[model samples]
Target: MSERKKSLITTINNQRKYSQVAKAAVLSSAMLARKNSSSRGAPGSAAPFGARESIAAISDMLSTQHKKPVRSSYVESDRVEWALKIACTISMITVCLHTPRTIELFPPLTYIILAADFISVSVFMLDSVLRIHYEGIFRCDSSYLSNRWSQFSVFISIIHLLSFLLHCYQLIGKLHFSEISLILLFSDKFFPFLHLNYRVWYGVIRSIRPFIIIRLIPLIVKFKLPKNRIEQLLKRSSQQVKNVTLFFVFFMTLYAIFGIQLFGRMDYHCVQPKTDPNNVTIMDLAIPDTMCAPEGIGGYECPNPMVCMQLNLNAKGEGFYGMFNDFGASVFTVYLAASEEGWVYVLYDCMDSLPSYLAFLYFCTLIFFLAWLVKNVFIAVITETFAEIRVQFSEMWQKKEVTLDEGFRKKLEKTDDGWRLIRLDGEVEAEGPKQKLQWVSSL
Candidate 1:
């Protein structure tokens, strides 16, 4: 082997030498690793045997099967999750960008990616169950259920588990040619709509768009952090949510004001003016005016239309809804795409607009979904960093470690350099006075 190849093996081997686990991995994969030659190709090329995976498969037994530590590194779990997730993300990007406009290549690759996702979901299932088993719901000291890790794990695990199962059902069904078209029709997002409760269904149908769900892994794993770290993270996330909420409220308040001031007043027409003989407009849908109808029956009888400014069409250049309009017709005839003509059509009532009442529901759902993404997905990442910060703060607070014989107060003295607390000998230096006493409430 060349010097570079030797160096890489040396580095990988050296890194693995710390833990017995790593040592086993290096030894087991040694022959497999040696086959590579830089002259032939890249050092870390794709595994000739199969797709590359550095993390060992979860299907392999975990020797230390004791309850996972509360503040665990989850080094293996995180590594595996990250490895597969990155692969899934890359493959998705590849299919979208370079893969040809063909049926066979797409489905096979899609199945592989989805299968990888299935494995990830399975890992989550195992993790959640293990966490629950380790951290029992009911504690002897406190009758109340535990808050640290397992509960949150169960909650997130259930959501993703259900998602995985539903996706799996669709995947299996799609393998059959007859179900392929239907699966293609409904797979990406409609499952959520179909599964949504009655209260949430309208919101799902009107504004739901397919989202790539790669960013949710770390989020579900967060509550497993140590108490101080969890508290600190929660504190930061809560603040962020508050700030975001305030910004959204202000933005939307302005948006609403702009809509009211800038939008023109309307002469009411029928809900479907061309289709319905009975005259009914949005105003009629809201108020049963004598002018709108002599009989008081506008809201009860008016038809509800789900309309969008249709852009980004499919292969046939069509929208998501199947029966919304006739396919192959003038695509722009019924649907608008924010063009001047489309805007004019909406104004003239040629292009239908969705009910304003439904928009609020969609808007609220979007806000919650975005908030969840930001808080759970984005904020969870800061836990480890937060933990590191906590460690620093803690060390700074505890100037010296107090031995059992020493005054338990951990003596504090205010001096020129600010309040300093003495720590135990050979421990860390205390940077500030001892904290005021606070009693813990019974759990």
Candidate 2:
């Protein structure tokens, strides 16, 4: 080619590249202007502290960091993003299987499980960092952290990360690295106070994995169902279910406190060696030593001891768990009694030597308060919330009228009254139906 032709071709290529870049810049600016104009009248639109400002700040930070636009979408259309989600899911499952309980179930695979867990955790950490960077971690009210479910998911991941660090610390201690570090540092002790069971922490971390499913709402929402039928179905009961759950938790806590004060401190020991004089009662009346001995009539097995020790023997009587022998058992027992699910048996178990009337009255009062009163209150709250939500859903469904364009092949127009379905011959369906009725009447 001639030198003039080569120069012309280069100019054309340069012009095309510049044109593309110009188009991108124009498109971005137009989108920003459109968004700003649309949001002008909205709440906090004029305020610099609004969501748009925060979003712009985040976007600027991300662009500064990567020199590129960050991709974000409510739908899972991107293959790379979908692949990452799947990888995270698989990694979470792998870590869950390697929990302490599951590890104990399969002892021989301990090392293999631990190795998989570590690899999965590393992947999770990388995934989290990527997500934070993409979501603009510099902004306090960024979309990622502003969302409740996102916050929950990130919090759990952070806890799991800490648990992983604890695992590493445990490994270091097991390998006597702590001792060597002490010698190297020329100190008497290296992290002497850093003592914790990493296995238990890992188990706790694994238990929190189930909550990650809440953050998978976008995936479920993205499903191509007919008219968002799945979302409608979920909406029907979601609010009521949430209300019931909160009420149940509140009542359970109240009942747990009641049970702890009432029956939790009772110690059932057949042989009462000593007793507090001021605290002496008829329940403290101990059976003869012969009766409690191995060769005795009861054979040292008293299902319901008549004598009660002043000191609690329930799991060393230390923390709440120790004091009750089981943290949730007291609440559960009260619940079972309130529900009338074998309340007689529970009361019988506690009423061997104590006054039967007092115990019966105490239980009957609890049944009245929890079963009759609280249950009705819970029902009323749920019913009211459901009714309100039903009204809102009806209003929303009715208001959700949509118009569709079926291409230029089908002519369409709107009238002052409502939409007028137009045909090629300038006929309207509403007029056609009326004209047909008039013709029939004339005949």
Where model 1 places Cα greater than 4 Å from the true spot, the runs are: 1-105, 139-145, 171-251, 265-443
Instruction: List pairs with backbone clashes in candidate 2.
Output: none
User: Cα lDDT of model 2 overall?
Assistant: 0.53
- The per-model lDDT (C-alpha) reads 0.40, 0.53
lDDT of 2 by residue, 1-443 (tens): 69999999999989967755543443344344446656877775564423333333233323333233556653224754565466457556765666557766886555665565566566556666666666766586655677765667668677666656655554554554477444534432454454332334444655665655555556446532222333454676677667776766776677667666655544444544465534544455554311222223222344453333334333423223312234477776777877877777667644543445645776777788778877887788678766755544543343222101111123334679764334445543555887889989999
What TM-score would every model get versus the actual structure? 0.32, 0.50
Residue pairs in clash, model 1? 270-280, 399-428, 399-429, 399-430, 400-423, 400-424, 401-423, 401-424, 402-424
Sliding window of 10 residues with minimal summed lDDT for model 2: 400-409
Of candidate 1, the 10-residue stretch with the lowest lDDT total is 51-60
| Residues 379-407, model 1: lDDT tens digits | 55456556655653453234213211232
